[model samples]
Target: MSTISETYTVTGMTCGHCVASVTEEVGAIDGVTNVAVDLPTGAVTVTSTKPVSVDAVRAAVDEAGYSLV
Candidate 1:
């Protein structure tokens, strides 16, 4: 299967715990293969087997206590 990578900007993530939280929530989504967070830039990159919807990613970020931009 081909993997897709999408990057999103998130606000309010300031530390490792924040990174872990975002990573865990996004990683739980269906078809998600990987979740990478760049704390310095508020960039969250998600790799999945299919294109994940922006709303789903936003919801996951919200659940993680962050805002997706």
Candidate 2:
């Protein structure tokens, strides 16, 4: 299957726990194959078999107690 990568700006990620939380939530999404978080920059890059819904991502980030900007 083809994969699509997307970068999102996430806020409130101040530590490793934040990164892990965001990663866990986002990774739980269907088709998500990879999750990379740049803590310093709050850049979250997600790779999936299909285009992930922004709303889903936003909700996931929210679940992690963060915000996707």
Candidate 3:
């Protein structure tokens, strides 16, 4: 399996709970294997077994009421 990591500047994460919510939502995608969010930095890291496309990731973030900046 291929491993890939991506960092996204996410908007709308104001607290740890928001981070957790975003993490869960993104992690639920089929290709996503791991997720980490730093609320203070507004950074979201995603690990996947395959090459997870930016559009797919952005769509998931958008669905969760957030934006991938």
What are the per-residue Cα lDDT tens digits for candidate 1 across 1-69? 889999999999999999999999999999999999999999999999998999999999999999999
- TM-score top scorer: 1
Q: Which candidate leads in lDDT?
A: 1
CA displacement after TM-score superposition, residue 21 of candidate 3 (Å): 1.5
TM-score for all models, in order of appearance: 0.97, 0.97, 0.89
- Tell me the spans in candidate 1 whose CA falls farther than 4 Å from its real position: none
- Sort by TM-score, best first: what order? 1, 2, 3
In model 2, which runs have C-alpha deviations exceeding 4 angstroms?
A: none
For each of the candidates, the C-alpha root-mean-square deviation to the true structure, in angstroms, is 0.5, 0.6, 1.1
CA error at residue 11 for candidate 3, angstroms: 1.0
User: Ten residues in a row with the worst lDDT in model 2?
Assistant: 1-10
* CA lDDT scores, all candidates in order: 0.96, 0.96, 0.87
- In terms of lDDT, model 3 sits at 0.87
lDDT tens per residue, model 2, 1-69: 789999999989999999999999999999899999999999999999988999999999999999989
**Ordering by lDDT:** 1, 2, 3
lDDT score for residue 17 of model 2: 92
Tens-place lDDT per residue, model 3, 1-69, is 778998989998888778877888899888899998988888899999888888888988887788998
